[model samples]
Target: SFSGPVTDHAASDDCGVAILGAEPDKFWHDHKGAKVNAIRTRTLISKADIIVVRFGEKYRQWNAAFDAGMASALNIPLIVMHLDEHQHALKEVDAAALATTRTPEQVVQILTYVIKGTLPV
Candidate 1:
């Protein structure tokens, strides 16, 4: 979950978040680790209705970019969260986001609007 009070906005019935990456025991520095990472990322992307990407320095990594690409290829609704001003490969992804946000609160609000299909302007 987002760890916020999104209920007030009627977020969604399925408001769950999954963090996909390497475990502490496995780092993404070898061929085996890379394969595992790719498979996990692909599975998560395939299952997600909407994929939220935190754009920053870490997103510059190839695996992170690959995940975004997979989400794009699958035609999932992708939201690019600009956690910081740092440039990342998310911008290179061809899929246009439904919206972009700079803060967690904004992210929740955007998710609410996206899932609900309406926003109280």
Candidate 2:
């Protein structure tokens, strides 16, 4: 991995989004089932090779820690990037995260190198 060492399971087949696959932000909220999406998100989080939570200033209600907690709960690799001021007090759970970066490009580079064994030129 580009950022740091992670578990072997962090490079599994079930990853969060294959870079350009789908918009991870609002696909669930835009859909019909909130309850179903919660379950699905849980299942996905459980199996994901990595969990990335981008902290932006716009959405006050988006629970980044909840997702981070889920990732930490599953012992999954986590990458957090804070573009805003609110960093919560998750303590050791936050320390357990693989990396906390500022740029999405860094996250992408790390994931690409981890998954594809190459860096973007």
Q: Give every collision pair in model 2.
A: none
lDDT, residue 94, model 2: 47
lDDT of each: 0.56, 0.62
Q: In lDDT terms, which candidate is top?
A: 2
lDDT of 1 by residue, 7-109 (tens): 2222221222113332444232344444544455576678788887665555234544565667777888877666545445355653366666677678778
The window of 10 residues in a row where model 1 has the poorest summed lDDT is 9-18
lDDT assessment of candidate 1: 0.56
Q: Count the backbone clashes (under 3 Å) in each candidate.
A: 0, 0
lDDT of 2 by residue, 4-90 (tens): 212233332223333224345565333333343455568777768888876566552245667777888888899887753444644
